[model samples]
Target chain A: MEGIYHDADLKDSPVSEKKTVVDSPDIAQTSDFSNLPINLQLDSEEKIRLYSQMVRIRRFEERSLRAYQQGHIGGFLHLYIGQEAVAVGSVSVMSEDDHVITAYRDHGHALAVGMDMDECMAELFGKRTGCSKGKGGSMHFFAPDKNFWGGHGIVGGQTPLGLGIAYALKHRKKKGACMCFMGDGATNQGPFYESLNLASLWGLPVVYIIENNGYSMGTAESRHSAGEPLARRGEAFDINWSVHQGHDLYEVRDAINNALVLAKESSSPSVLEIVTYRYRGHSVADPDQTYRSKEEIEEYKQNKDPINLFRDKLISEGVLSDEKANLLDQAAKDEAEASAEFAIASPFPEVSELMDDVYWETDNPDQKVSSGEMFFESSR
Target chain B: MPEITYREALNQALSEEISRDPNVVLMGEEVAQFKGSYKVSEGLLEKFGPDKIIDTPISEAAFSGLAVGAAMMGMRPVVEFMFWSFCYVAFDQIFNNAASIRYMSGGLINVPIVFRGPANGGTNVGATHSHTPENFAANTPGLKVICPSTPADAKGMMKAAIRDNDPVCVMENTILYNLKGEVPEEEDFIIPLGKARTVCQGNDLSIIAHGRSVMVALQVAETLQEKHGVSVEVLDLRSIRPLDLDAILDTVRKTNRVLLVEENKPFCGVDSQIAYLIQEHAFDHLDAPVKRVSAIDVPQAYSKALENFQIPNHDRVLAKAMELL
Candidate 1:
């Protein structure tokens, strides 16, 4: 296949050959996110809710992997196994008006943004109840009402889209911001740089959040990204920059909250490089722990499981009782199970509905007016 | 009524639209400070200020995508491309993003924007800067392509484009910018998209054309009537997409012959669609096979003489119409 052939050529190659020396390893180790001014003030309930959301995302993916193996789901499925905190924390900080756009690894992001569990599950199942009406599967779960733009398949495709959405918000004088989430791999695309320059030049209200999960599919971040501290690229375009621990949901939430505030109020562009890891293979079809060692996964799980770390913090600080935490975990598991059942029983999209909703009738004089009338003059 | 060049009429229309609607803004390289390379946006920056009349870096894809974003947010954005040839750099943003967003979002988003540029090959801009993309935008489903020859249509269509809900691509020829004509004084008169105008009425054959070709078609219409005693009906397809098939059908039914003229490559040019439509809808009415006069399937040459040879002109159109007759 063309994809495999391209992958083989890029096996040992870096995303870009430009090398720059940076004191990033020291910065990564000494990064005290708790000291950040934007850190969240959370009670027991809020902490548990964030944790539960991450657990739901995890549990959903585990079930989805089984379903894919059982041949219930088809097409490309990029799992969000290890990078739950990034989506949960960032999305948690956003308002109903704030928008989000992301790359292919999107099921977790969709669930985190308050999409109905059954709808997301139905999407993976390719049923009519899916958000995209079974047209876009796991990779394209979109809920525009929720302000989630898409689950884009193309690696760097969503960068320009995110910038555009932010520009729209600014142009309308709306107090809205767009969080454009992309992987470390997409940082190398031309549109990434192009989007950065335009976003900064125009001062578009957008926060570019790069989830540097140390890999593009199977390739390590070290093999990609020119500067280890990807946040520095923001300086070239005069965009405010920050690096946060992706595993620490609190830090991710705090960073996103501040960034959103800055984006919305100042109407300025910024970038946040969240260092994280993914536990599953790039897709369900690929064997896990092959290109990467099991030790690396174990290391991340033991020391940096965002949910576990946050749970321990809540317990030690007397914010959450162990029993209460256990109850929350069980509730999330139950929710995931219910969602799976609902999706399995849901109907596929109707055959007759193939050609509907293709284009708007703008040629009609009635539809062309912008008098703050009804969105569309629908008989229904 | 006023006598002004097609370019001046467009500039005036843009200025008027921006003044009329506070939400209307313009963005392009040299559009604001440099007053636009062709002076189409002259004195705009002084009147509208920098925020509305923006000067962007040499990033067509980025700026075009930004315009798409701006338009989707309910702001009417009129983006200048400097030249239509530069659109290739941002083709993805124009076709995929601006054009597809309304449809893909299930009509939740309306990309009410216009990408105006000097389209068609006539300025001896060479191969790199001399493409007429009527066929490209026409092929895209959700886009509205407008190519106006007269100053009246230029101003009216531009005003309509600014007020349109869907994405519209306005292709203005650089050569025709200085071609003077009478434009209505009223600001509210907007010619709707997809409506063809009878530039000249005759009974023998319809010389169907658009953009720079409209003039050639009219000139050929006169020649055919005078020399060959063949009356020619000319219809200027102002809007390429949602083409006025009724006008073409009416003319074809009367004349029983059609000659499609375009300056783009013959293989997939706008003329091909006109020919196809004539064959499909007006096949029975035709006394002879429908004829097409298109540019040679080669990159536009730099020399004026070479370009003249490649592009379809009045003589070529007249010959083609004669053949059909």
Candidate 2:
């Protein structure tokens, strides 16, 4: 051992070659949650909260799907059905002040961030009472007061904006990180790479989460990306990259908690890849059978349903009885039903609203006059 | 009032804004330790330090999109693209993210950011490098395209654009960076966005232009007034998006004729909008047909002779004004 001072000097020796460096999974599953550490342990209240949040998202998405099918919701309706564990688990770890932005599949993220279900439904219905005041449809939900930036429509569009928000938080000395969510499909985009590069270089406080739900709409990841894991893309940026089981709430929350700690404490960014499955068609219009099989869908619902897994975990751990879990699911359904009613009752925006909100306030005197005369603003 | 170049005026505006608001930061390629691509940010990095003055990598998408996000969180960022042509890479950020974010958010947040750089053609930077994209931005709703012609207006508009609640695009002309004019020494002096200024008064014909072409229009007006006794009126469009249609219409009414001098191509240009507006609003007032002097419908050539032919010039403006008269 003492003679092996340098690899250069032992170039011709029989035992000269360097030890083989092997790649292993960065995040290991502590699936045996019975022996969970104290700091990483989930309390009964926290578990209840996570279960309730996931259920709410699940119920809202199911209602939204019905609305889309019944022709109440317009435009594209991308449901976050089987991927509830990802949003609930990841967003539950975020501080109230921490910003969250995501791609078009935003119903789950919006509900997790405390956006009103009725307003979100109204937005889906293209009514004035919607989250975005009906200006943005199903794909865009914005709640800045709750630190939810938006649900961007373009693929991979929010990645750079996520970096910008982190920069602001750091610059403003705000004690929070931004949780930016994108799909597995977005990993291949230029904005994602560009944003990751800058976020890594600038030490931005961002938790970049790519929820790999197996497909981008109908195209499977294997065909699109040669079966490469999305987190592997973060390797080039030298960020703290990790992959976790998306179907497991415990693992997702724990991994996201670690990322949040890294970002908030020291302005470090972490790119996390979560393996999940989407239970719905990409949008309401998609037939969804072309890219995958019906058996696969039925199998996921039976075995890997996040809501079922978490409910069973709670029941098994004696945190809550089966009776209580059913109550929570019922409550979530009631709220979703109320949202549907409100969406129907909400009125469409008036014609005058078209000219409104284009600018903050048209400050110039020129806006006061018509083509005819020098009319004052009060008259106009 | 001190006379300064457009570059220095911009530098002063940025310097004063960063000093005034700690949240205001400047980021772009070669904008910090390297002064600036055009030296407009000279001495800013040394004065405010790296936290306020940032030199970004050549990833326009990242920096531009980051500025939009920063603006959302109440950080006013002034992102400089080395050239408007380079902004082609970040158009998604500019058009989709920055422009659409506010309306999408129900106007819950304000993107008080300024995306600025040299945007016009001259000095033989061929087709890819040359663009007068004010119309492209103005066509979209959420963006305010400010094209300042003089050093004073550059200073005023730079400050105002930084302070505006919406994302304002400051389209600086490359040819006019060295041109000197009187800039106000007042710290808070600002020319609000969407206000057009009449540089010269006349009753014969109104020659309207923006950016560096305004200088050409001024020259043409002076030549017409001095040599031809044409009484040419010059209207400088300070901001293109929220176009001051009243000012243009008033000038057209007074002059009874108009000659639009645009440095952009003839088709679907800023001039096209103004031409349609005049015909729509001031048709009765117009005695003769409204004429336009625009760059030919071709990519800007690198050759000097071709570049001169492509962009609208004083001679072209004079010819257009004569034709309108």
Candidate 3:
């Protein structure tokens, strides 16, 4: 807990014997969103829908954990179990053409963006039919049709790419905003702040969504973030920004929807700070229960479980029967299982494919045939 | 033809490119109002306005990425990094996004983007601002790296790069910006990317160079031919990445000797690549090993004397060429 504060300043990274720690016991509870005005906007059906989506993400993640353990998937896997509402609420309002680019934790966003469960599961299994043509594993999922750009691996790497997508959208006279999702840990990167300043100055249509899920992997936000409030960074750049409870799906949806509308109308960039939590460790491999305590996880689950709270609202308003909720959960499970099976049966890419997509084929006689397809076809 | 400085030629090229293509736009810090830091973007904001001539915050990563994205969405964006040293921050965007996007998108995306900037040791900018990054860009695939030494070449290449589908890195030497030369009057004339220019002709030995080294090699060639009684062929390798291997091979085949000059570091430098290329293609014609005149393997120092020693110069080119001959 004492080291969590120290861990924030990477200049002094704590040398723990264990490489990955799960929990941050000293993570300060900063806000009680239930009392905020943003909380009052959630109606029963909306709440239940949000809760159902969160549950879907959670259940899907649990199944994925088992699959990974059973050797069904390979490469790095980042789960969005604790940070479900960030995706569910923010993505709920985006149009088909609006862009969403994020770092590795992308399953929830993929689902939120309407990528078929089977396809997503297949992609994770490295099937050719998957979104990235089996080239990208779990951390590289992309659905261009859904305007979901990537599962960028590097921390704060997508910040500039997101800005570019927005610039492109604006340049082409497309009235869609780019929602760039990064973690609180990524904010430590100099590019994160630099991107904010540039995005705001250009009046680019971008929504920088910092899903402050406490840890930047194992390092807690309290330890990593400098004295400056992460959300208020937008104000320094004269960019419009607001901090809200990320666990409250209604709050997140309203904030993102409002931000998108403002960006569309004004052609300006905005920042939305979603104070959320991630229940699972940074990756599938880390237990994450070490840095933080069980009591804290139980506390958030008991007090601020977005899915449970929404389910209760739905039941109280008679919007859904317990039977319907259980059925949807079962359906999601079956979909994940079937996709995994399909992916398992699928074959890996052939050796010939290794040389494809390297260059654009323009006719340059000097170019060697061995260079493959990616070359300028200049007829000189 | 009009005699103008390299910087003026660059400015003229910008005006011509923007006027020629409605999609061509310029972005960089101090590109608007204040003209340009080096005045290469002077009078562009007034002509193109803020939308087309954007002055970005000092977020190289963000704007560079933005330029790549804009290029992907059917726009030709010309971005300026004030100094070549500052380009390190945006290498990811340049190498990963701008350069790799077309290939990554399965050729669905075309990054017709130009990253233009001043580079090389000059005016005591110290180690940070004095790197010649042609070799780095050349090392990256899917990028067209050009370092033109003449005003005419700068104008022609800048225009070509603005229109080229692949990402092009146009490295302008900071010290050469003020150097004057005759540029052709034709506004539409464009020297294609990946092509080299033979600056001078000879039969005794060939001098392969680019950017500032092109000027140095030309001076060295004139001195060697006139004063030292050596017939020197000077080849200005205008583009570094898609090297002009044909010219290099033919010249080396005729002369049977070569001196590769560059202002970058000796290790993995552009000069080494030229030497390697010549050896690979025209080894049978080579009468002697290709000699290299390059900056010493050390960072650029603040002291002018040390900095000069760090970069290959005219004397060094002449001396290296004489030894090879």
Candidate 4:
């Protein structure tokens, strides 16, 4: 297929008129993980678990995408296919007291926080058995029990909420941090900047993870943002910041672990810009062809695919044979398939349950402390 | 009971709630060292210390959203918007995040956050600073809006809002801040939300209002009885969302003539909903068409001469009441 980047097409293309895309700074490359701190270093079982978790997320995203294509899922379907390691690698370092919150593309974080595929998939299907009981849909998945605050839909809206989580942890004297994730596009939102100021001012324990997936929807990072590295904006607010390659799961884990430690130990906030790429469009509704060349997507997939990178690392370390890796991949595919089947079989929410969650008073009528009518009967 | 100003009543409520629940925090710009912009949070910092009474930068979106996030984790934040008109900058945080989070989460999370500050237009503060947003807040399903008309109600409703398990918007008035009324000294004196208070009972006309307009209704009720020889019943809608529909209907059924007065604009205002509710439920009882006296549909003028006429006053209520009679 002819890519979007052609010499003849470049002169007419409006996107080419903008600043030439600069290559990202090269990160220190090391295949060995022996020098990592004792706590940060992963055991063979932990390594396998992280690898399997990433595979599960990739499989779940693929299945969800298929469901969206098949017309089973409605509204936006923001797959976490290319950015699985960012969520999995970071969430692996959280303690029980820590919390996680992210923007619309939240399936990876939801799965990383140990949400079952059945409930997560059911939510995508808008079924009664879903995590939010079909009320939240895809961008609003929540598990307060798992310390996963939400799947907030707004671009940069969750930044303050993430700050609040850190505030609560500090107020309660709990030793944990909050991992607030947003896309490269969310960097320009006013709230994110405001949140950065407060997080630094109050010394709240929050690690803001900017998953720079190259494009903010169709706009490239250079076109969308003024800064070279988006994470450097934190310095203006006196926040510590660093950048890491997202596809290298080990690098991601190490970078996030350092930020989490800064948060938990010093009650300080840090910004981690994970240089990542997304194969799919911003949402499934978006067309990827208009934004970048197919070659750009292919290069990232072939060279820096997170799952393949981690799998190869584990294989080279003699943790598993190729047969064992294939079995794990097959198991993940089967689990994802089973989850989709469960979602298909699950019932949609009843019409009677429409007003149930609007108010806590309405839900618990027996312990209802509030008075007067909440819902207008005439409107119904 | 002790005679106290509306500001003092609000101050007492914050003091009591902060003492009652360790989770309850008072946060906003000028809430700590500088005191509240209206002095509603005066002496709170001295009483509760800096941790409980936090002063934030003039960043409404950040602080309001921070409070909402804290509330989700069971912190019970009482965010004071220096002026409720300033809430527009943080509308996405309050309207979208605070109001809809619980419902969107399927009851998995509760935002026990209170967004309180003066939200009236009679202070010559101009259109930018003066916004009566009870109607706007009430329009959202997940939020509960309260417009307390008296010192007693202010203290009671503020306590109730802090204790409530959902996001509550307490819309107050700067003009009413100095008005004195007898407020109860009880610690747990919470006037339940969605209930109405009939200030004075009569049968000739029903003067339904909320916030400072209720005071205008009371003064109008007196003049109607003295000069026009027409008796009037005043119904104060303390809470806007879980509206006191029973009281409104009862007053309408008893008076037979209804007149709605509010500080909001005429089009799609709080009175619009009340008038519909009366005509819908008690149309048979009403002898005349339900009348409404709201602020003139325009941005609040900064000039003192025109601003007074823009909001509902005693004369406007009386004139509208006479038309109904």
Which candidate number has the best DockQ?
Answer: 4
Per-residue accuracy of model 1 over A1-380 as CA lDDT, tens digit each: 11111110101112133122132343246344644554545655776788788878877777677677667789777888778899999988888789998888999889999887888888888887777777667877777778887777768777888887898787667789999999998888777889999899888999999999888887777777677688889999999999888887777888899999999989889999999988777886787776789887776665576766666656656676667767776776678778878889999878765544434553354674322111211221
Question: Residue by residue across B1-325, what tens digits does model 4's lDDT show?
Answer: 7899999999999999999999999999898999988999999999999899999988888899899889889999999998999999999899999988987888899998999999999888899998999899989999999999889999999999999988999999998999999999998899989999999999899888999999899999889889989899998989998987888889989989999999999999988988888889998998999999999999999998998888898887788888887
Please report, as a residue range, the 10-residue window in candidate 4 chain B with the lowest summed lDDT: B316-325
Shift of residue A261 alpha carbon in model 3, Å: 2.4
Q: Write the per-residue lDDT of candidate 2 for residues A1-380, one digit (tens) a residue.
A: 12121101101112223222122131222354434452246788878888899888888877777787788987799988889989988877788768899999999999988888999999999999988889989888998888889899999989999999999989888889999999998888898988988988999999999999999878889877854667977888999898888878887878888899999998999999998988788996889889899888776665577777677667667786666877787898799989999999999989767655566644333543211221112222
Give the number of the best model, judged by TM-score. Answer: 4
TM value for model 2? 0.93
lDDT of 1 by residue, B1-325 (tens): 7799998889889988998998899989899888898889999999989878999888888888777766766678898998989999887788877876654544456678899988888778799998999889988877878899999999989998888777889999888988999998787868877788998888888888899899889888778778888888889988887677777788999889788888878997888877877778778998998888888789999999988878998677776776876
Cα deviation of B46, candidate 4, in Å = 0.9
Error of 1 at A196 (Å): 1.9
Q: After aligning candidate 2 to the native by TM-score, how far in Å is the CA of A319 from where it should be?
A: 1.8
Q: Candidate 3 lDDT, tens digit per residue, A1-380?
A: 11111101101111222122123332234333434454556565665666667766776676677777777778777888767888998887787668898888989998888777666777777766666656666776677677877767778878888888888788778889999999888887877788887787678899999998878888777778776568887888999988877766766777898889888889899888888877677886787777888777666665555565445545545665667677766776677667777777877767655435444435233643212112222322
Error in Å for residue A277 of model 3: 2.0
Question: If ranked by lDDT, best first, what sequence of candidates would result?
Answer: 4, 2, 1, 3
Stretches > 4 Å off in candidate 4: A1-34, A38-40, A377-380
For each candidate, give the TM-score of chain B: 0.98, 0.98, 0.97, 0.99
Model 2 RMSD in Å is 10.7
* TM-score of structure candidate 1: 0.88
DockQ for every model, please: 0.30, 0.43, 0.29, 0.78
Model 4 gets an lDDT of: 0.88
Task: Report the poorest 10 consecutive residues by lDDT, candidate 1 chain A.
Answer: A2-11
Q: Which stretches of candidate 2 lie over 4 Å from their true place?
A: A1-30, A38-41, A363-380
Per-candidate Cα lDDT values, in order, are 0.80, 0.84, 0.76, 0.88
